[model samples]
Target: MSAQSLRHQLLTADKPGRADLLFGYLRAHGNKHYEEEGTQMQHALQCAALATRGRESATLVAAALFHDIGHMLADDPVEANNPTLKDDLHEELGANYLKGIFPEAVLQPIQLHVAAKRYLCTLKPAYYEQLSEASQKSFRLQGGPMSEQEIAAFEQHPFHKAAVKLRGWDDQAKDVNVEHLEIDAFRASVLEALS
Candidate 1:
């Protein structure tokens, strides 16, 4: 389906229909390469697997699976990955797109996951060194690291901890060698998250 059709489905479909449309969309577009080593589908599945292994709530697991969806939703997903472009703000775009379909438990973490990266960079200088080269470049595009005030505010958010955890999984999810569950494995969680 075209992006317009998908958006229409998301806007008008029932919960199950919305989930179906989203999964279909992912199946269609998720094979594209991400900024890192794995395909976008691989990253998403890896992140969701990590969340499930960590025994996160269903909502959080669903959030992990779809956190980078804005990259797909971008006018040009390939270009969105370019660090030289202004930060795509994929986190906010994804969260906003999912707002009505998912509860805050899912949306908040997706929204804050990028900020969580900046927060971690501030909290642990060593963390910056650990990022993949592509992530490090995008980090600069994403405002380098957070300030003390930004950290303070991030800490105060209700979902900060979840976002931090999600960020950790995001950092780890790029391994090309790691095996991951298929997108269908997340169907239950996705359906459950839909409102």
Candidate 2:
């Protein structure tokens, strides 16, 4: 992608107006995350800020903030007997999107969040147990229930630590107030630079 186009996607836009626009644009009934009990945009902000609280780097923080940005455009069903993250894995989508717009530092955390999820499910028994049913089910579909060997191998991956941290913050971020940051600020920052 060109520099300008890459520059554009990194921009965040999810507060009030952008949130509504995102909902209108991305939240169709068939869409899974739209009616998934929490606002998708709110979820993203919480995840991002949560990571920041852990003294995580800004890239990881940004990754947390926009971790599920792709899900805003995800294809999930709201009321299905079997909930699935079967659509495009938001991690890859969000990571690729980040790659186009941000540095590898940012893209790495996003790309690895799912792996982080899988890794956590393996090492932390209670941790995996704590996941929402939808989240737990996702681990299976997303290559969860990893074997001992798989877990051992995963530990060696470069981003494994960051991914794990991202996962923790991602889960702990389920707060109403944490979503308070203005996406417009991040959006304006990126847009202003490009403009």
Question: Per-residue lDDT tens digits of candidate 1, residues 1-195?
Answer: 555545556879987888888888778878888568788989999999999999889999999999998887774554344343354578987787776789999999999999999999988989999999999999899998787899899999999999999999999999999877888888888888887
Best by TM-score: 1
Q: Which stretches of candidate 2 lie over 4 Å from their true place?
A: 1-35, 75-87, 176-179, 184-195
Model 1 weakest lDDT span, ten residues long: 78-87
Candidate 1 collision pairs: none
TM-score of each: 0.91, 0.67
Model 1, position 16, has a per-residue lDDT of 81
**RMSD versus native structure for model 1:** 3.9
Question: How many clashing residue pairs, candidate 2?
Answer: 5
Per lDDT, the best of the predicted structures is 1
**Relative to the unseen true structure, what is the C-alpha lDDT of residue 112 in candidate 2, on a scale of 0 to 100?**
77
Cα RMSD for candidates in order: 3.9, 7.6
lDDT per residue as tens, model 2, 10-80: 34542333333332332332123443455766666567556655766666765666667556434423211
